[model samples]
Target: MEKKDGSIDRKYIPILVLLFMGAFIDGLDTTIVNVALPTMAMDFDVSMSNSTWIILGYVLGLAALLIPAGKACKNGRVKKFFIAGTLTLLIGSVVCGFSKEYAFMVVFRTVQGIGAAMMSAAMPSIIVRLLPPDKKGIGMAAMGGASGVALILGPTLGGFVVGVASWNWIFFINIPFGIVLVLLAMHCLPKDGVPDPSKDPTPLGAVSVFLTVGLLLVILQNYGDKDQGVELMIACSAGALVSLIVLIYSIKHDRERAIISTKMVLNRDYILLGSAFFLSTMMLTGTQYVMPYWLQISYGMSTMESGMFLTISSVAMLTIVFWVGKLVDRRGGRSSSIAAQLCRLVLCIVMIVITPPDGLLILAAAMVFLGFSQAFSGTGHTTRMIHHATPGYEDESTNFLLVINYAAAAMGAVVYSMIIAITLPETTLLEIADYTVRMTNDAVNFTAVAGIAFLVLALVLSILVPNRVPDKSGKASEASDAPDNASE
Candidate 1:
């Protein structure tokens, strides 16, 4: 149960496979669900505004719960958490496949998010603990590569399913994947990294969850189809404000048990990289959120066609990230990250200038470059974050990535929803297909502005990061007394 001569302990390869599966499914779910939204809307008899909750709800559930569950990950329950999570996700997927009502789908998606949070909270820590320093970069990259594959194939795969089968297959497809992962977890996984059970979760943390959810709800409700939800928006805003006050009080008085670890937040590496990640999420994943709708609604593209086009970008992303991860290992994350940001900054400019009227090839070129930019930046940042993880705080470090990533996602959904709702506030999307081209351009223009703002901020913060992994005297979080890494 330790690192061998120049590779991972062979006994633990099964565990690594399970961990990779976990990463793939979690990442797959994030991107795949977006492609099916239009079909789901028709099947469930809901408006475009309501259909979007399928996306927002999953991000919300994951964002709100990851904080508490993150700390709880140190509670010696890794296997149980992972098993329960996969099972819950399996059940939720099956249920989602059979969702007869919009309410049922939203609820199941939320359930899936919760399960994903559990799996995500545990996987990185395990990966970190198991690998030697030399491979951590590759391990992170490999895990990321799995997600990148999911990102690359998600829309296309989901679209294919929607085209060939029903959208229900999107969820149902996870069934066999989940079954194998669960069996492997039951058999070969080791109970290493036993967490301190005494570190009980505090109620103060729960309040922050409520506050986070309320804020997201307000954002969604305000931008919702004009037919309904204004009253609910006001109520959520009030509730969020009240919770914010209570959360501040709790932070001041019981700082030790606050929802987020103030110490972890203050960690210099965490701050720099976390800020960069937030901005990237808004720009990268935000585009993932809106582009499908934009394609279908504006260009009258079929779900399958949109998915194929989007796959171009994701393919670019996967290739760059895989290669750049090696570059991060050889050089460092900061340099790789800054370069990626510059690439994206230029892409934003192109978006602002090119406009959809420039035609499909032009747009497709921009998408490919955007994916390349993400691969470089996202891969480096993740390696840097994992490189900086302090023992006893690994879970927090991992959770920091998930929180900002999903929080930005939830925020992006709200912002994009607002953009679409404001520009084309019609209660019906049926006619949006024939809506004026100028309106679509206006929305894309505004989106470019938002992208520019977030990307600029990301570059500024990323520049301040150290050009190399910060020095940590401790060796790898090995499973047992192990030798220094020889793989390098």
Candidate 2:
């Protein structure tokens, strides 16, 4: 399948649709679970701290498997990975829906995360390989749109579902969607031969990478908890350190023949783009972790109401992504990214100064602005990263960037959790068993710290992004191959 301009055939639209669906499910699952947390805690008879692991477990699972899954895709097994991932996610969701114990639910959610990691690493690479260069921005925008729609609707949808149905519906809802996605993917996704690219084809290295990421996350989550025993902390920390060393060694040993292709990380453009994505994830995910709690605890609002307010930000994000994509295509990525970061910095300042009771409206407005800022920064930075990826390294580059993004997100969640736990007194309860939860001054402080972090990231981004045009050689060459009448 080939295009007039030597790009992949346009018939890849069906595959793009599959990816869009996958992204929508991912976004929905992330936010939708928030509304169900308290209910889950009650059902499982766990403390709020332990219950938080419901979310943390999924994230940890994703971080652990992301790099390995990316490697798999780069080894020319993308279609197979997608099919396997979708089936796994479907089964996991079913298990989660039926889980009666906290431990069982956590395990199922981890499985779901593994599915997410596989699909996430494959989607962008598929788009890059299939779409024409000129349409790259639009293709990404469509992917972004699916995410935005899910984010916008997630809270409200979850709240309503929980209110009308049972919390279990949240997981069960994925069953049908997953089935359709898998079938569509099998039919639409292109087939490629799978060859062991690395000299060491044993699965031990992949297992080691997964364990390393998981251990580090566990340590990070438990680092500052005084309630945990000293022995636990020491053990977690030691495991994390060892895992880090092993991960480094594995990467070095497989640098050339590995599916991840270490050369992708060596590129200056990839480094800058990946770092920028990491910072953005730090800010965005951190804020997401805290915001729903703030709304529910501080404002005396219903879960559905809080979700509706959060949806406003998603609406703004969707609109801004399309606009930013066009700007990146026209003017290049660096300048657009710097501009977006500047906007975010200003918004963060506005967020920090406004106190809660008097500032709820101000916070809502800030969130809307933040949505736009994130879209601009994410779209521009990601486009630039893909533009600079070496030939045949597109899958590896996409995977590396996404892994960095998810890692940052996991760190952000852990940091936010620690801040909330530390700032709030032990006697202060954010929620109780079927009892009203009250907000304390500490909750306000947590949001303020998160806002400050965003400002810092924005400042760094403004300084780092270069002002230059994208190299259009690849696109130009593809265009020259087109028939004379095909020239627009």
Candidate 3:
């Protein structure tokens, strides 16, 4: 339903529910499988290395398809894709639950990942394309909150499922729940746009993107492994470079139909926003990778206790996203984004200074601020990108955003791991059983200092972000004008 004063109409509630569920399921699968990995490994008689492929398989499949799927959301039949994605995930999950072989389990997980890619690519773009300017923030907040909830609940739910039944139930649980959501989505989702053949992304463009992402992920994941051959890394690096070149050619050949649009690639504000987003994601992943080790080592806390403490951060994020949505609506994306970076700046400083035990309260405060930073920056950058996107290309812009997020996650973990490895070659973070509290603080401080450098760069970029892009006539346009009535 359309409203007069920018408030959500009653008719839109079903759509929001579907979006939230889609995001929640996609995110839930990411973490829920972790708790089941040991059980899965035992059941399948596989080594830990082999079991890791289950996670890697899904990530590779999801990351490779995200960009192509984003284009499909705009130029292809979206409703059909959404249904197909859900059904695909359902089938994969059921098969995964019933699998007698480890290889089959990994293959089906990849299938589930592809399905997730379709849903994730379409969901955020739906908010931008389908909702009004004032209402888009609310939709984004709902979607973001779903992710936060998934993060908090996934492991706990996984543990409970494994405790009571076979680990396969984790996948089995999605069956009934997914089916209901799919039916609801079919009824509530907006009608799909007509397929535009002329705007179809080229096969070469899709292949290039797939190869580039897949190779990059592989390289990042295997970078420091002694078992991984240098020749393999070199080959993958070359393949990625070639794929990037092909992508550049495809974009130049057909900017309108390329996986990534030329207008977005060339836009200064888009680049700045993207860079800031990438850096922020890196900061988050780096922190996540290191924090658990620091907590258990320095605080003398058990794994469970450390996990429970970390949950507070997600709780903070989940709580603030609801409020940040309204704040973005009132203050605008640029202002909110700048505030987000400032929050990150403070978080980094706090992490640098706060010691464990005595500074536990300060550390908790920093974690809360970290959540606030994430909510503001994540939502603000998204809205800003929507605002500055070229007219008729808002959906296409989301492809770039999702691609950057995937790349940053992979890169962040590897980059920070490398930094730590280089700094303390004598002992790894996990092997620091004999480390003093002071040594642990030094390590965390080192990471925090690195985080500060990145955050500073992001802050500068956030400051440079403009409100909107100018049209051919040199007049600036409102983001709402881009696809204001496209959904209708």
Candidate 4:
């Protein structure tokens, strides 16, 4: 749907809503499921460690399928993909709610993750192809806002649901929501044109890419248990290395038909923005991985209290991203991104130098800054990446964002945990003594300093982004010719 007199078309509203819902449910599932894991473990009679595979199952599916799914969308079958994805997710959610065995639940969750990968792959392309140039920021902001809402609500909502009802409601609740989203998809999404078979990626390239990402994810997720996972990590590392070698060979042999073209990977703007995203995501996830425990130990707050406090950052993030997104539309992503990194740099400094307080005042202030930095970077980096995407390579840009995001999350958690473990090897929260508290605070500060390295790198990358990049020309894929179908 095209803009009229510089305003977004009225018909695109439902499409926008559908996109928001898609991102919301995906994000909500992420946080909500984490909250319900304990309950799930008890119900399934599995150890907490084994129950984690419920989450890992989903992650593995997404990692394995993301490359293939992204390649599929490059041909512009977004509407078909969205419909099928929503249906797949719905089926997975339904089965998960009624699952009688732990193995079945993990399998169902994997099915759910495959669906999420498809939908995630399509959302940005839909925005890039369907929304007018001036309105793309708004679309991104709406999706960001939905994610923010999910982040803020997921824990609280999950707690409420599981406290009063069975953990199964978490999955069951998605059924009606999924049905509605599916109907919206059929009605609101634009139709696609004929796809070019030649544009499809080679099977070898797809498989290799999948192996690289999937094995890496496995290693990152389990690396924390050094005692139990040493062998597994080594095997996965070898597998990932071999997969990477194959991926490189395949790309060199057939750059045109590879899952990720050499041109796309080597593009100056793409690498800069992508590296910045990687660093920023790494910092955000790393700090978050350690922050809650730090808060609890240093401040003597309960788990619930710490979680509620963290929502402050989510609220701040939600509020700022929309404004930053609008700024992106009016000015450019480069400036917005620079400003965000600067804020992060300042926050990191504050965390390092400021003395730990007995009260929450300093920590609360830090959360606000953290939120602002995250919002600015998230909106700016993504919007700029889209703007700088090589004309016909917009789908690849989005796919790269998803890939780095997942990788950064896994890496951040593992890396930060290691840092904390090294710094406070003997510290325990079970003791409420002053000495233990001081040690935890020291560990947190050291982690923040490490985070600065990432933020600095992100800042450098943001600076490297050119003031302007070539805008994507008219869409090349099948999605280009279908504004009217959205109305139908």
Candidate 5:
């Protein structure tokens, strides 16, 4: 069953497929509803502000449940929860498609979010648990690549689906894939690993919910034209601030028993990995969120034309993740990440000189490079994070890494929004469609600066990444680590 490289046998392929299925759905679910919001709001007879909850509710659910669901993975219940989560999402998606009321839609979406949290939290731990060091990056790559592709394709695909079919069809699309994935996961994932769960939920869970959800709400308010009012936003922001203080206090008081441990809090490598993920995501989302508007507004391109440009960019990213994952496996995290970061840095620097019409072809070329860097660096960071996953807290480590990604993306949206607001005349996202070329050009200029700063920060962090995981024993443990993955 062993390969000459001291990796697991080919049997892991089916397991990898199952894992990717979940990951892809999780990524797609995040953005698939975005393009359909306007139609959905009208169909449900709700204002755009109220309809926004459909997105907010799902995101809050995801943030609230991530840590708790991750904690559940600690006990040998990862497989149990994984299967349960897939089923929950499957059912929830179908129900969401059938919803007759906005409340029902929100509730179903929340259910899907809970399920996604479990799958996302459990996946990295399971991947690390299964693959040997030599092949581990490839495994993580499968996940990262599937997710990256989904993120790229979701909005475009959602719009196409909505144009041809009802918005409900978007939710329905998951049913067949979810059903097959659930079955494969149930049958193929290694027998459940040893569960080492604590009985108490502790104050940490509630605090995390408050901090993550509250901050997300505040971010959402600023990230868009949602005028939820100054007072309400202030209240949400205050709640989030208090929650952070409570989290710090808990970590300080109960380092060992706390969900957020001092070891994790203070670890240098973990901090670097988190920074790399956060900053890289900020660059990605900031650019991606702006590019479509920049194209449509600045060049007077149609929606479909701008979408095609993005698709080309995404296709490039989609192609690179696969091979970069293998490169990560061979080169190790530090080298791969550093190289990837450098590539991204070059792309951002080049993007500064790009303008509409005269620079369209050049921009497309830059996008190709952008996609490549996102994939390579993304896979590298993922590989390192998984390889360095804390022994006793594999789930927690992965959970925190993913949370950093989420937070960074939200931050990117808010940051880009602030830049645009400061640079351009006031315009809602809905109204931004009609923005003048001058307004769009201003947004692009500001976005480019922000992207450059983020990439620079990420590059510095990547330099600090340990080239490879330190094998303290300094001997081949490949054979030894093999069986542990099967039963640990």
Candidate 6:
């Protein structure tokens, strides 16, 4: 399926741009609302606890729809879904901009989340399908670059926007970008047909997946919370039981047609790769969730200041991802992965040892190490997962692995939050002037928990996973020393 001129078709460039645009907006929205949460609460007269629904609503919507959206993409309705999602996002943004009540804003935010889910699911598959196998790593890098840039810039941009203008402007900003993406996508994106229904539709299997994920989130949210009353505990337990039952039933009944694709799951390589991805993301995202709060509360810094400090990690990640990609292509998965995990372990220990009152400069340096660790591990994990995927199941394999990665992230966030909520009250430090010591203690405790989890997970993954590439002697091996072809 090589194109004319011995190059990937340039026709896909516009589509990539559109997908990148969507991802950028999604990133922007996440950070923009984060800085504006206090403002939103004050304006709407809601408690901080209630205002959190703005975030939870979006996550719930995304979790509910991600797998189904992937199914839809495989069924060849990608363009339709993309356009619909764009419009929905546009409308949701407008609704959010105009919302004066907390309930109304939460509902619209959920709508935006649905759009985000559809776009996220469809975009990667489209990228993979359009690019040649040889060029896929580069293509993935480009897409990943866009996402990385958004992550690096989002909080800073959000802080600036909110500081200088009204919070409403953040939502309004997406309108122009959304319109342009939709129009370009209509012209540039190809229309794919429906997937063959004769090949195991698995509608019921999909339902079981939805239920399982929902129950998992609920359990994570309630974990370690002191207010878990008898009814809440009973409900969580029941939910876990139901999830297990549905999962077993799905495995038994749809042994061949399960939504998670049992064939992929059964592979030893895929299982290990999935586990590695899950652990890597859990550590990366947990740190991301807590770091900014740590900077702001511990150092008495503003949102903008915190973001600036955090950018050091993003810069480090950006540089390492390129090198990591090359290593994955050349050196085989095992060596790169093991090295990355070891680096992460070192960096995590460094961060934990250098507690607050160590000054922002020292913290920033630690974050740089942390960021590099994340990039190296993340890139290795993703490359390994893709390289080990069964042929013709690239979409399913990649999407499934990504879902687990995100699920791990969600769980990590909840765990970190709960740890913070519980430990802050117990810390002996008195409240400091111009600093929120309680919140700072909470973040410190959360990071410690995440770091410990990462170390154990990395050790386990190192022992379990094998390399995807062959060695120099033409023998099958996990740690190849051959160099990658740079031309690709």
Off by over 4 Å in 4: 1-8, 34-57, 94-109, 165-168, 221-226, 292-304, 345-357, 421-443, 469-488
lDDT of 5 by residue, 44-109 (tens): 876433455566556556666766677666557778878888888878888998999988998888
lDDT of 2: 0.68
Q: Quote the positional error of residue 392 for candidate 2 in Å.
A: 4.9
- After superposing candidate 5, which stretches have Cα over 4 Å from the reference? 1-8, 31-59, 91-111, 151-156, 166-168, 191-200, 223-228, 252-257, 300-304, 346-351, 388-391, 429-433, 469-488
Candidate 6 structure lDDT: 0.64
Residues 249-347 of candidate 2 have per-residue lDDT tens digits of: 767776664435566777765676677667767767766766665566566566678878888778888877877766665555666566566666555
Predictions in order: lDDT: 0.71, 0.68, 0.71, 0.71, 0.67, 0.64
> What would the per-residue lDDT of candidate 6 be over residues 1-488, giving only the tens digit for each residue?
22556454666667657756876776666656665554565577643333445665565556666766776777787788788888887888899888887788878887987887777677768756775554444445555555566667766675667667767777887788888888887887787786766444366666665566656666655555554567876786687678678766776776545566667778877787677767766676666666655666666667666666666766777886666655555565566666656666655666566656665566667677766765666566666677777766778776676577556656556566556645653221222222365557545665665766775776577557766652332223444444552222
RMSD of each: 4.6, 4.7, 5.3, 6.3, 5.3, 4.4
Position 36, candidate 1: lDDT: 79
The C-alpha TM-scores of every prediction are 0.88, 0.88, 0.82, 0.82, 0.83, 0.84
Q: How close is candidate 5 to the true structure, as a TM-score?
A: 0.83
lDDT of 3 at 424: 50
Give the winner by lDDT: 3 or 5: 3
**Candidate 3 on 169-246: residue-level lDDT in tens?**
788766776898789878877788689888777888988977887777667655555556899999999999999999
Q: Could you tally the backbone clashes for each prediction?
A: 2, 0, 0, 0, 3, 0
Pick out the ten consecutive residues of candidate 3 with the lowest summed lDDT: 479-488
Lowest lDDT 10-residue stretch of candidate 2? 476-485
On TM-score, the stronger of 5 and 6 is: 6
Error of 6 at 480 (Å): 0.8
